[model samples]
Target: MNANELTIAEARDALAGGELSAVDLTMACLTAIDAGTPLNAFVHATPEIALDQARAADARRGADAGALNGIPLGIKDLFCTRGVASQAASNILKGFKPEYESTVTSKLFEAGAVMLGKLNMDEFAMGSSNETSCYGDAVNPWKVDDRKLTPGGSSGGSAAAVAADLCLAATGTDTGGSIRQPAAFTGIVGIKPTYGRVSRWGIVAFASSLDQAGPMTKSVRDAAILLGAMAGHDPKDSTSADIPVPDFEAALTGDIRGRKIGIPREYRMEGMPAEIEALWARGREMLADAGAEIVDISLPHTKYALPAYYVIAPAEASSNLARYDGVRYGHRARLGQGDGIVDMYEKTRAEGFGKEVQRRVMIGTYVLSAGFYDAYYNRARKVRALIKRDFDEAFAAGVDAILTPATPSSAFGLGEMADADPVAMYLNDVFTVTVNLAGLPGISVPVGLDAKGLPLGLQLIGRPWDEAGLLNHAHVLERAAGFVEKPRKWW
Candidate 1:
């Protein structure tokens, strides 16, 4: 197999055994990135930075070398990489570069991982489809005939890069299913650790309370390895948890015997596709066959999750994004002769933000407005609390993990929903937002292919800070499904 196609585990072993050089692996990925430009997976290419790090890793090779030493991975555009373009796929921050690295990137670098470049994402992470990106949609490597499919968002580029072998793996953030949905659509593995499990210090904000960074990789084991290097306590981020980081890769024994997996009845939506339903049923049987007891559970507030997420995410987004008013940094609109400060703010924002971003910001601003705060923002907050309570109740009742469909459908074509009602796109996050609302760990594992030959995935939601256990459950599902399909190289 090509070096670029190797999983993290395989690459690590080869690097350790002196069979593979860091430079070679880095070159392999860089070459793939250049050849795969049609997919627009990478918005920035950092060959100089990557090669410097790889050479340093070669010289420092020893027993004390970091876990990811010499490993090449892609960084999401949301991360603030010192001296690299750190725009979060938005025009507002075009040409902006950070002076300091984000906590996650710093940790990965400390652990010896090399960065290829920054991957594309939804503008400010405000959309479910990658179409919201200012760089144009990051096309999925998977295609049916001549139609182009979305890789999912706001981590679409991360998903596409990893799935297409443009990089060994990539960093991704999930606010409302960005990581998991893309992983599902691209037939890979993605895990959104519990909120606060990973530091938010360097990642660009979307919804402060809901956004959590994670790894997107070729396999469950790769996800585990990358998550180990990416997670730790960060004094820089106040919301970062102080818990001890475990050896996540070692926790994957692929034995989920006697674990209680809950199948939330609320997840069975009224118009759910028969293929998705069948996929969910198959997931249940797989877990049961692996000795996990499948039990019916109720998260009654599931129906309210989508509405509540819309209000709360936008409300937080509006507040967090207020910092990008062209006063401090980023794109500033050229004002007319007599324009004042307010005019610059209005014009800069009008010119910088895409339509989807503007829509969410407006919704957020409206919900948080004086007269509507109680009716929208506050009410949504209350519903969010209930959603958390529902998950907590299930876990408290001996449920080891909860299983659900990662997305309502498989990958959809680009522009398929762009011109449709925005809510139609929001419905894509129906199964995912609840996990973010409750601040719990969740993962998407590819199980089977749809009738159209596209991949489908199932989600496994775990208790807060229980990613190791959740990963083990997913590992078992991955093993049972034995899904080895890859997108034909159309790029």
Candidate 2:
């Protein structure tokens, strides 16, 4: 059996049925990672620890088993894992080990999931491509051959590991498009559940309001399974929804015969590559073919989403990341000190944050500063309200969901956009950011390959707490698109 290709749902069923032991699953993941290391899909792999956990899980099955008796998953480095280095893929957090695991990760543990190890990512989940990692970039698995293509970031490694079958599925965080974009590039399914659906407490916060963790997997059902394990109310995370957790697994109705899907014309912009546009059009056709009613809708605030997200997310990020300045925790950079404590904040911040992080902080500082607060930060906040209002209007108008190209283009070669103006790179997140800003659920599912043979993905957006609807829509499109490709062993 192709263990690498097995979905989390399938693997658990097999494990439950005693067809494959947790030991078998662990070995499969370790073997796949050993083979996939050339692609640099993972930052860390603790085979011994994983084996121990698998053994414990196998023993538990002999006692009382659960749905996730023995699934192995790649954890994004951003989630704080107690006693493990949760570095956020940045040099600044190099030696920072947490005393407590993030709430989402702990729940995954309780659900009986085994940890494969920490996966790589863009520094502080900042970039569109994985090139921003202090450890170096993660390569896309489906470059058709050994051709170099970026696994999208900041959750690039999470997506790549899933694509290369390095892990059954991996945890991913989407502050902007981190999860969705990378998932799109690697030809996998990744969902950014509604903001606050998954607890952010102990997650290395990039942008408090926008930062959210979800699942990256080969199939929609797998995404659903993992999301279920990661999501719940946590008193520790004030923003976490107090709403009831639904049966994400049970919500998978393979039929969406009469649903209304809206195609926002604003998403069909001038900069979108022809291949991506075709994929978007193909998605509409796929849903229509699946008996879904398709309609043309306008998210009048669409064009404003990217800018609004850039402003608000960074503003929140600056505040959230302020804690990393030298003293209390993380990599204490050698900062020139003045006589007092205030000097530490200044010197430490200057030394600790990377250039990109510094840039956002400065931008945030400038926007939130006395003179500009009303004009910049406040205006962006108002626009955020409009963006959410736009989604509410669409849903109220009877639109069950919306569709757009997950990315404007497929995976670009690493370093192609790295040295360009940082704003240039941020532009690539255009499609995925709005969902985060609106606190709505969204997903990316691979649809086809591009001219360079890199995978392309189509994104589906749904109402808040409507992950099930999003997954059903994606499954329908996945079937209609008829797209599936595996990484060749050339790497």
Candidate 3:
């Protein structure tokens, strides 16, 4: 395989064996990124920074090397990389270079990973498709009928970069299916560890409670290796869980015998495509063949998860984004002659935020308004609790994991939904929002293809803090599916 095409695990082994140097791998990725610029996967390119890190990794070759030694990876723009522009794909934070690194990225660097650049994402992670990005929509590497498809969002660029072989893997944050949906769309592996499993210290907040950082890689094993380097408790983030970080790669024994996998009845929504249903059925049979027991289950409150998530996520986003007024860091509007402070605030925000972000902020502010708080936000919180309880009940009944379709459908064209209702876009997350609402671990593994030759993915939802087992089960499924198709490089 080409150096740029190597997975994290493969690259790490080659580097350690002296078969490949870190500089060669880094340059190969840089070349791929340069050639794939039409995809708009990366909003920023840090070739110099990548080379410096590669040289340093080369120097630490012998006994001092770390687990991720000499690995080249991409950082999501949402991550606060010190001295790098971390804009989160929003114009409000354009040119805002943080002075410190996020805890997750810091841990990856400590393990000797090199940063290629910052990948694109939805503006403030507010959209299901990457169209909300201020940096222009990231085109999926996968195409159908010569149409440019979307690489789901808000982690679209991470998924695109990985699928296109621009990087070994990339950082991604899941806020209501951002990571998993995009991974599904682009035929890659993405895992959102249980909330608090990975620190959120310097990641730009979208919805404080639901957003969790994870890895987007070329394979299940690569996801495991990257997750190990990214997961750890951080004192800087109060929500970070103080738990033992396991060797995620070592946990992939692929021995899932006797494990009970749940097929949630609620996931079988009306109008679900026959292809998705067939894919789900195939995933069940694969797991059953691997010695896992398949059991019918019901997450009764699943219907309400999407509604409750929209309410709660937007409410938290409104509060969290209030800090972006022109007074502090990030872009500020030029004051007009005789204009008041209110005018500056309004104009600056109006110019900075995208349409989708503004809409959510308004929805959030209205939901949290004095007269509507009890009716909307508070009610949503109660419904959120019930959703969590539903998952809890399922786990208590011996369901080791839950399997479902990762996305409602395969990737759609980039502008297909532009004129459609916003709620239509929101429906894309119907299969994914419940996992974020319940704060559990979820992974998307590409298993098959849709009618148009686009990839389809199966999601595996696990109990809190049980990522090791979740990854093991996913590994079994991946091996059974054996999907190795790559996008024909039309870009």
Task: Please identify model 1 stretches exceeding 4 Å from their true place.
Answer: none
How would you encode candidate 1's per-residue C-alpha lDDT over 1-491 as one tens digit per residue?
89999999999999999999999999999999999999999999999999999999998898999999999999999999999999999999987999999999999999999999999999998887799888999999998778999999999999999999999999999999999999999999999999999999989999999999999999999999999998988998999999998989899998888999999999999999999999999999999999999999999999999999999999999999999999888999999999999999999999999998899999999999999999999999999999999999999999999999999999999999978999999999999999999999999999999999999999999998999999999999999999999999987
RMSD of each: 0.7, 1.8, 0.7
lDDT tens digits by residue: candidate 3, 1-491: 78999988889888989999999999999999999999999999999999999999999997789888889999989999999999989999988999998999899999999999999899998888899999999999998786889999999999999999999999999989999999999999999999999999999999999999999999999999999989988999999999999988899998999999999999999999999999999999999999999999989999999899999999999999999998888999998899998998999999999999999999999999999999999999999999999999999999999999999999999999999999999999999999999999999999998989999999999999999999999999999999999998888
Ordered list by lDDT, greatest first: 1, 3, 2
Point out the worst 10-residue segment of candidate 2 by lDDT.
331-340
lDDT of 2 by residue, 1-491 (tens): 67757888888878877888999889989988988877787787778778988998999995566557788999999998888888888877778888998998899888888999999998888888988788888988876544588888999899889988888999999988899999988889999999889999888888888889999998988888888888889999999998887878787777898899999988888867888887788888989988999999988998888888878877887787777767777666454544466776676666656677788878887888898989889999999899899999999999999988898888788878767888788888989888988999999988888887778899999988888888888888887777777767566
Ranked by TM-score, the better of candidates 1 and 2 is 1
What TM-score does structure 2 among the candidates reach?
0.96
lDDT of 1 at 23: 96
Better of 1 and 3 by lDDT: 1
Which TM-score value belongs to model 1?
0.99
Global lDDT of each candidate: 0.95, 0.85, 0.94
